[model samples]
Target: MANALCDTRHISYAGCVAQTFLFVFLMSAEYSVLTIMSYDRYVAICKPLHYGTLMDSRACATMAAAAWASGVLNALLHTANTFSLPFCQGNAVDQFFCEIPQILKLSCSNSYLREVGLIFCSVLVLFGCFVFIVVSYVQIFRAVLKMPSEQGRHKAFSTCLPHLAVVSLFVTTGFFANLRPPSISSPSLDLVVSFLYSVVPPTFNPIIYSMRNQELRDAVRKMMSWPHFSRHKLLFCLYI
Candidate 1:
């Protein structure tokens, strides 16, 4: 944003490193949180009786801490490994952000194989988390299907579907952005894919969740009507 406003594309070495670390950390943490949310939904829908006991405040706090810790560890490993490489190629990055793949493009050494290996391992971990989410949702759906009441099923679907939509959007876009074939890669395509995974999910998440909340919707409606109501009251007072 600062660069765009200033009409300059230059980023300092330290700024690049910071951006890389922060981007990876936040993205990793978001995935972890999403995984945890799947578990939460599973417990709520599948084992309602034990939900409180299983997802207690302490347990939630512990999981949250672990997620942040994993993010930090991931960021440290990728940032350290990536910036350590010598860049003989030009510093220009194809993507809008300081991502690992874009940074790897700037490296001109065989040592980049190390970072590639690390990325593969990271992908495996992320895949495991995705599988966990899938399994949890399967269980949740099964339980929802077993419910006798139509309203109950509808409520369960309503709660779970938004989360599933968000997870699908996040995971699919990210996977495509990172794993797409090189033959079809271009600057514009990369930027668009990057925006989809990096920008769209976060931008939509709150809207998706808030839209499901009846109280929030009501509040928003009331807020929207307030100016009109105030104008009517002022006119009546002037006429009186």
Candidate 2:
């Protein structure tokens, strides 16, 4: 309510615009991406034999498109609900970011309608993806457990380990924060939750999946050797 405290009367249209853009972008990028990972596991586990055929480049692209559209639409509803109310008396916004509840707190309007709508939208979109991810992994976990070969189980879990960890962290922190009372949400708790939601997943994803892959490591070594060979007298002469 910086604007209100300073006696400015309304929420800045520009600020709302910026916040809407960020909310939409983050929803589409991070949250929807989690669905793709979940669907991928479904393909790999539920239809392993057909995964190659079912998830060809075009099919994967289409799935990604669908997920992006869903996330975008969901965010639109939330953003519209958030800014739809008129704020006449006060203009103090809450949170470091445009988190839904924070915006809800700032408005003077009877917030029940928007709050209910926000809860409904959040449950449908975020919790929906979360449920699918959980079910997909439960099946995957079962399948991995049932594999006759230890190697199979190890391989399956290894591929899923990073995603499973990321999903758990995101969902758990978010769920607790949303479920808990406002009085319970402190800066330290929010900071840790934010890190789990945003930073940890991006940091671990590539390194977890790609770094230890033998094929990639071998390609790197091969490329390095090729440069050395090219620098040798005969190879250099041939290159010249």
Best by lDDT: 1
Q: Which residue runs of candidate 1 sit more than 4 Å off their true CA positions?
A: 222-240
Q: What TM-score, computed on C-alpha atoms, does each candidate reach?
A: 0.91, 0.72
- List where candidate 2 sits over 4 angstroms from the true fold: 1-12, 186-240
Error of 1 at 59 (Å): 0.6
Candidate 1 lDDT, 107-214, residue by residue in tens: 989999999999999999999999999999999989998999999999999999888989999999999998999999988898899999999999999998889989
Assess the local accuracy of residue 55 in candidate 2 as a C-alpha lDDT between 0 and 100.
86
True-vs-predicted CA distance for residue 199, candidate 2, Å: 4.7
Model 2 Cα lDDT, one tens digit per residue, 119-209: 7666676777778888888888888888899888888877788777767766775677667787878767875666565556566668666
Q: In model 1, which residue pairs have backbone atoms overlapping below 3 Å?
A: none
Model 1 vs. true fold: TM: 0.91
Score residue 179 of candidate 1 by CA lDDT: 91
C-alpha lDDT values of all predictions: 0.93, 0.71
